[model samples]
Target: MMEEILYLGNIIFFIFLWRIILQVLLSVIQIFLKKDRSSTGDEYHRLYEESIEWMRQESRKSHRR
Candidate 1:
């Protein structure tokens, strides 16, 4: 009976350790994904600003004509 208890305890300990490892991996993946999304958003915002400026310049030229 004592041996059986020891075996069960070892199994439980291993399972707990495995869960902790998986949590750490998932956290790292989430951080990486957030960084990737922010970079893409920054690029899109810069392009939008440039297009708005171009439109304003064209409007001014049209008014001069």
Candidate 2:
């Protein structure tokens, strides 16, 4: 019957919505815990900048040779 089909559809929609909400909640919890694992902060960025600068210097030296 149409009524039964509508009820089933509603249940399916609710399940899907709940799953999406739980996934978002889990992701937030994971991100909160992930930050505790590292204390490096902006050090990785500084290292990257230093490496790039070194590469630029090497490139310039090679171009002159």
Candidate 3:
């Protein structure tokens, strides 16, 4: 029947729409996670640099003595 065909077509259309929406949401989540990871990486890098500087100062003090 024509009504059944129309109902099936609508269902297919909705499925396609939902797929697109889900993809977009996943992309947004990925971007957010990447940003968070980068920020954490920067913090870790800063800590490493500070540790290196501290070690260098300790070495210099030992050499002076």
Residue 45 Cα positional deviation in candidate 1, in Å, after optimal superposition: 1.1
Higher-scoring candidate on lDDT, 2 or 3: 3
For candidate 1, lDDT tens digit of each residue in 1-65? Answer: 99999999999999999999999999999999999999999999999999999999999999999
* TM-score for each model: 0.78, 0.55, 0.87
- The full ranking of all candidates by TM-score, starting with the best, is 3, 1, 2
lDDT of each prediction vs. the true structure?
A: 0.98, 0.90, 1.00
lDDT of 2 by residue, 20-55 (tens): 999999999989877854545567778989999999
Rank all candidate structures by their lDDT, best first, as comma-separated numbers.
3, 1, 2
Which regions of candidate 2 deviate over 4 angstroms?
A: 39-65
Error of 1 at 61 (Å): 3.1
The candidate maximizing lDDT is 3
Model 3, 1-65: lDDT tens per residue? 99999999999999999999999999999999999999999999999999999999999999999
lDDT of 2 at 29: 90
Which runs of model 1 end up more than 4 angstroms from their true locations? none
